[model samples]
Each structure stands twice: as structure tokens, then as C-alpha cells.
Target: MSNDDAYDNSGHIPDAASYPPRWEAEALAFRHALGPRAVTNWSYGDNVRQVFDLFMPEDPPKGLMVFIHGGYWRRFEPGIWSAFAQGGLDAGWAVVMPGYTLAPEARISRITREIVQALSFMAETVPGPIRLSGHSAGGHLVARMLCGDAMLPAAVAARIEGCVPISPLGDLRPLIDTAMNADLGLTEREAAGESPTLLGRGLDVPVTVWVGGAERPAFVDQARGLAAAWGAPCEIVEGRHHFDVIDDLKDRDSALMRAILG
Candidate 1:
């Protein structure tokens, strides 16, 4: 195997090819069920991909839960992950899944900023505290928001009650040598600058770094490194791998929901 193979989650998992079609079907059914409550294509920027899908709970929302989809910053969109918002929605929170320009089109730095814009818009549209959660590269984006360089409004920053970056890529330096960097287009400088691990202390909010015990060792190290940098809690769920680790996003009673909704 190649040196960068350690970052390859799909290759490590059997039947990985089935995940996309499954997600698409589940997300479609979820949107169909929500009907009007699932607000689609709310734009935060002029770009088509800058839009987000919001899923509101039946009762008044407890707050907002933003789940950013992760595909190494170069794949997937908000709609495909709609089903994942059910956990937050079930918890009486308005859940949002934002789409940003992917790598090869927009730099990771810009994607990070776009999420900030998405959160700011969500803050204006939804009242109450904000909870941030993302899987993989998306986890990197949510963590980036807490960095001072993100420049979130004091009010918006203050409302962020917690962040859970699941199986996150906390550091980017290693990617420079990986094969995906061709599409990621990350220079050494860009990787270092974009790494949440190298950035200064984040906003004063609760943080949890969660990874699957069965995930790639590199990912486990990334979670540990991130938690160490922020002095936060790190959760390693046994028997779970990268793809299945975020499944709890659709379950209200799951530990993931308690961390996000609390």
C-alpha cells in the first residue's frame, strides 16, 4: 500500500461502494417526509453551492445544529446528508447542512470562510445557541470557526455552545504528501495555515473530538492531537469506522446528539 493509504477510509472498508446510494435514498426520503419544514436552497452567498438546507423541528426550536458534510473537502453536497440532521431535529433543534465550493474549485481557506458566512446567516435566521458538528474535512471546517482568524461576530461566536468534529482532519500538513492533495491543491503554506491544530486557541466553547476506534490510525492520531491542543474531550467509539461513525447523527438518543444538543 502507498504511504498515504492510511488516510483512505473507503479502501479499508468492505462494500464501501454502497454508501453513496444508501445515503442518497435516505436523504431523499427524509426531505420528502419533512416537506415544508425542510427549507431547501437558502443561499448564504452568490455561489450556487453556497446554499444550505434547513430542517426545522415541529415545535419551537431549542436552537440550531449545523452539520457540515465531509468528503475530504472535494465531494458531496448538503442535500445528500439531509437524513443526518434527524438527530438534531428530533432533539427540537433546527438543523442545517451547508454546502461550500469544493477543492479544485475553491481553496480550503475559502471553504472555511464560507462556513463562517453560513453560520452567520443561520444565527440571523434562528434564535438561541448554535451547535456545530461535522465529519472528516467538515470537522476541520467547524474547528476553523473557533480560531480567532475566522472573525465571527462577537454575538455569533458567543452563541456557539459546543462543537463536535467527528473523525476530523485536525492537521493538514500530511495531506501535502498524499495523492488527494492534487485535487485539494494544498501548498505547504496553505496546509499549515488551514490546520486547526496549528491555529491559536479557539473560542471559549465546549469541544469534543470523536473518532471511531476502527478508523484509520492517522485519523485517531488527528483526533488525539486536536483534543490535546484544545484540552478537550476525545471519544473513540469501538467497532465503528469512518463511514459508520456519524450514523448517530440521525438518532436523538445517541451520545452524539447529547453532545450536540446539550
Candidate 2:
């Protein structure tokens, strides 16, 4: 594989091809099981991609848990991660999974703004403490929310309880040399400015960086770097890889879920 190709994780996870459908199937079933409890396609912006799926229990929610799907900022949507809402739903917390405009069509900064819009809308609509978590590129986006440039409203920003960036690319500079940059179109300044590692302890909310033990070294290092920079903790899911490490979000009783809830 080309050096750039190596940096693109789509080629690394052998089971990557299977996860979309698996998540889709699980999400569909979970939605069906939820019936009236689930709210799908809640729009936050004018763009078609600016929407989210929210799941809730019978009682008023104690808080909101939002999961951002990862596809290097260019692939996948919220539908594939809806099943992950199950854990929080069972715990009496509302869960939200948002879809944002993809790369190539939208620049990274634009995507960042789009997510901020989504978060702002949800914070107003849901009206509760919000905890954010994401995988891969989604992880990067969650981290970006902590930056000063995100421009979240004071009321909305204060409602954020915690953040868990899983297998995040905290440093975007390396990605400029990767094959995905053709789609990402990141300039040097943008790469440096957008990097969580470079931003240096911008978050006021608590952060917990997570990665799979079996993930690429770069991914592990990224998690470690972000944790160290933010004075946060890093949790490595044993034997999981980039694609499957997020599976823990589906299980309400898992340690990952506990960490998020805590």
C-alpha cells in the first residue's frame, strides 16, 4: 500500500466492510423496539445531512448522550450508529446521533460549524446536560467542539457534561500527507489550527480519551497525546480494533458505558 493509503484506516480494518450493515441492522431493530420512544431525523439545519436521531426512555431524561459516527469525516451517517443509543436509552438518558455534511462537499471548518449548529439545536430542544462521544473522524469533531473557535452559545456550552473522543486524530497535520487529503483538502494552517493536540487544553469540560488496544499505533498515540495534553485519562479497550472498539457503546453494562456515564 502507498504510504498515504496506510494512513487511511479504511484499508486497515479487515471487517470494516461489514460494520455499516451490522450497525444498520442493529439500529433498525433498536428503533423498531423503541417504537414511540425514538425520534428519527430531527433536523438542525437547512442541509439534508444536518439531522440527528434521538432515542429516549419513558421518563424524563436525566441528560443527553450524543454519539458522532466516524468515517474519516467523509463516510457513514448517524443511521449506522443509532443502535448505540440503546445503552443510554436503557439508562434513562436521551441519546442523539447526528449526521453532518461530508468532506469534499464541505470543508473541515464548515463541517465543524455544522456540528456546532447541530449541538446548539439539540441543546435547545433536548434541554439537558449533554455528553459527547465519537469515533475516528467523529472523535476529532467532538474534540473540536471544545476549541474556542467552535463558537457555541454560553448557555449551550455550559450544558455539556463530558466528552469521550475515541480513536481520535487529535493531530490533523499527518493527515495532510495521507491519501484522504485529496478529499479533505486541508491547508497547512487549517491542519495546525484544527488539531486538538496543538490547541492545547482548550476544554473546560472533562475529557476521557479512548482507543482500542488493537488499533493502529498512530491511533493509540493520538489518544495518548490528547489525554496528556488535556490532562485527561485514556482507556484502551482490550483486543478491539478501530472498527469494533465502539461496539461497547451498544452495551449498557460495559465498562465503556460506565466510564461515559461516570
Candidate 3:
């Protein structure tokens, strides 16, 4: 079997089937708990998918923290991730979660651009230092935002305080021949272009890579490799899986939240 086959996560994580209903339940509960303070369907682009929701703290915000949801650039919704905003909100930081058009319908490159647009919009609207965090493919997108060739303006790029790519897909080349790439439609050029590990080293902003200790080997390797390549620190959350690792973001005092703040 190829490295692509070996690194394929859907094949390795059995609990992948449970994410939606579980996330949906949490999202619904968050809506009930927060009420109108959780703003929904704020448009960033003309497309219906280019929308984001914002969760604000009662007091003035310290900064903006954007959490990008992961579905391998294919599935998941921002609504399902609204509950994760609790930590940032409690920290006196405003949290934004943006939704994007999924793969097959939109290429990875375009999705990257969409995220840039979302961040740019948020940067203009929020007007403060920004911290980015994401899980799985969303982690890939967060890391991609730091790429040297990224489309963000010089001023906007400077506003990026740090990034936390949780359980990120740092190296996309491994997915070219994997089952995961079918919908991603990644070519050699696209994979290399999107892969943060291949994008050079020592970024201007600090980065922290987070991965679940109980996650698949490929995910561990991706997190470790990206940290080593960029000279960033990698935090392994012991006993957490691909899904459970991100749950730490919901706890304001958790290491994951601290990392995001840093």
C-alpha cells in the first residue's frame, strides 16, 4: 500500500461516524444557552457558503480568534462548531467560525481563498489582533494562512498574533493518491502548494501544533513533522482521539485554549 493509503484518516478513525449528531446536539444546546448573542449567517462573499457566525463576550473583547471547522475540506458546518466558542468567549475574546464551500464543488485552492476572504472580512469588522485555530483539514487551512505565498495583505498578515493548527493535515502530498483526495481533486501542484511543511520555515508569527495522542499515526506524524519543520512546539493531548482533541477548546482553562491564546 502507498503512504497515501497508510495516512488516510477516515479509514483509521472509527468514531468518524458519530461526529455530526454529537456536534449537532452541542450546537443546538449552545444556541439555547447563548440566545441572540450568537450571531449567525454573516456573509463574507456572495456565495451562500461564504458565511460566518460570531460569538461575543459581554465585555469588550481582548482580540479576535477565528476557528475554522474541518470536514477534510468536504463536510461539516460552522453551526456544529458554535459550542467550541465558549472558551474564547469566556476569555474575553470574540470568536468567529466561518463556513466555506466544500470540495468537488470547490477546489482546495479556491477554498483557501475563501478562508482568506473570511479572515480579511473578519479583520476589517473586528479590528484587533487575530489568533487562528482549526481541526483536521481546518488545521490545514489555518496553517495555510501563514504560508509565505498566502493572499492576505501585508497589514492584515501582521495582525495575526499566532496560530494553533490542531490535528492538522500539514502535508497534503500524502493525500494525492489516497481515498481522501477523490473529492479534494488535488493535483501534484495543488498538494505541494497547499502543504505547509513544503512551504518553507520560520514563519513571522509563532505557531503551535496540537494533535491528539490517541489519534492515528499519520495524524501524529503530520503534527510532529510540521512542528519540527517550522521549529514550533507540538503539544500532544494524551488520551484524546481525532474528535476528542478539539474538545479541549471548549474549556477556557484547558491547555488547548491556552495554546490558542498564545
Candidate 4:
């Protein structure tokens, strides 16, 4: 089936908007509760405008999991989702969250490059294997980071053990037809290039695609498409939605988290 046919969001736009308020509030609370850590800033380019926050563990971690926040490459920043690190921390994993120049200001290609640069920096500075994870738009970015034209350094790529993209948009063409694409300015070619499914499988690394059982059908289908394309496993988180699925990462027994850390 065509992407649009497979993942229809015709009636759930309003529900998608309302999914995040509680999660956002929880994230804010976590941000305030955590003690200070060494914050480092790295720039990809003048126009690209990329920055990442590295939350170092009080003790060294066995590996690092870099999280790319989802905002359709238009809205939201890394700071809002920093609470996610707690899950990694419990698993002895350090976390890196990066912010990229949003759409309308920078194109998708530039944003993708910025993510590559951010990952490159982390690979060089942070010692150990790396796993990638993100939610919604961030989830899409993580999948892109694993596909063709991946700008990651050979060393970093080698050290990447797995990917966990939660409720990702595996394909971008559908967004092109939606109101959300207004700022993205995604041409047909750009959409195809940005799509992980269209690009084919390039990484041998294991990938775990997770979505909330409560999420819009489109998101669940998006996760499934990526899993099918990459020959990875697709998981549905019980009673979760696009906004709250990441919260499961905080629970050690969460199926989504287990797939990621495994």
C-alpha cells in the first residue's frame, strides 16, 4: 500500500496536539530536579546552527545513547526532553541531546547534516558504544542517522550497537500533504531523501522501532514501515501515545526500553 494509504491521520490531528501537555510538564519537572552537569556546546556551521547538551554520568558509563528530539524538524528544542536521560542513567548509559536549526530557517538536508556533526562530536569526545533513540520527529532523525548517506564517522558507525526510534515518521511524503509540512518546504526529492524507508537498508546494526499503542495509527504504521524496511523489530507500548512512549524508557522493565538497551 502507498504510505498515505497505510498510515492515515485524517481524524486524529487534534488528539496528536493534546498528547504532549502532561509529558511536557513532567519533562520540565525533571529538568528542575536534576543537579548541574558539565554542559558543552558544539556548532555545525553558521547557517546550520546545531547545538547539543551532554549529560555526563557522575561515574563513567559503559555506553552512550544520543537522543534527537522530534518537532517535525521545525519546533521544540533538546532542553525540553532532557528528562529522558534518567532512563539511560539507570542503565549506566550517558545521554546526549542535540538541537538543530529548525525548518524555514534551514532545510531538511542541512538539519540532517547538523545531526551528523553532533553525533560525530559525541563519538570523538565520549568514549564507548553508542545507541540512538528519539521520539516522533526526533525518531525520524535517528532512523536517518542509520541509513544511506549517513554522515557519521567510521569509528562512530562501528561503535553504534543499535537504534531505538519511537513513533518515527519513516517516510516524509505524507507530511508533505499535511498542514505540518508548511515550514518543512519539502519537495518531492527532499522528502524521498529524508525518508528512511525510501533510502533502503544500509546499516547492519539492530534497530528497535517502538510506538505507543495509544498513538495515532499513522505513527504506529510509520514505526512498522521502518522495521520492515530495515528488517528490525517493531514494538507497541501498551497504553502509551506518541508523547508519553518515551516515558517507558525510564522504567527498566519497559518493553521499549529493554529492546533499546538489549
Please report, as a residue range, the 10-residue window in candidate 3 with the lowest summed lDDT. 1-10
Model 3: per-residue Cα lDDT over 37-154, one tens digit each: 8899899999889999998888888999999998889887899888899999999899999999988899999999999899988888787899999999899999999988777887
Residues 1-262 of candidate 1: C-alpha lDDT, one tens digit per residue:
4448989999999999999889999999999999999998899999989999999999999998989989999999998999999898888999989999988899998898899898999899999999999999999999999987998989999999999999999899988888988898889899989989889556989999999999999999999999999899999999999999999988999998898777
**Sorted on TM-score, highest at the top, how do the candidates line up?**
1, 2, 3, 4
Q: Count the backbone clashes (under 3 Å) in each candidate.
A: 0, 0, 0, 1
Alpha-carbon runs more than 4 Å astray in model 2: 1-5
Off by over 4 Å in 4: 1-29, 38-49
**Deviation (Å) of 111 in candidate 2:** 0.7
**Model 4: lowest-lDDT 10 consecutive positions:** 1-10
Per-residue alpha-carbon lDDT of candidate 2 for residues 39-156, written as tens digits (9 for 90 to 100) = 8898999988999998887899989988898888898888878888878888888888899999899988899899989998888767778898988989999999998778888888
The local distance difference test score of each candidate is 0.91, 0.86, 0.88, 0.77
lDDT of 3 at 238: 87
Question: TM-score for all predictions?
Answer: 0.98, 0.96, 0.95, 0.88
Which pairs of residues clash in candidate 2, taking residues 3 or more apart in a chain or in different chains? none
Tens digits of lDDT, candidate 4, 1-262: 3444334432444466654565567666776666575363555445534777777766888788888888778787776676777778778778888898998888888888888878887787689888889888888888888886876778878998989898898988887776556688889999999899889767788888888888787788788998898888888877776566777777756676677778
* lDDT: the better of candidates 2 and 3: 3
Which of 2 and 3 is ahead in TM-score?
Answer: 2
Cα error, residue 4 of model 1, in Å, equals 2.4
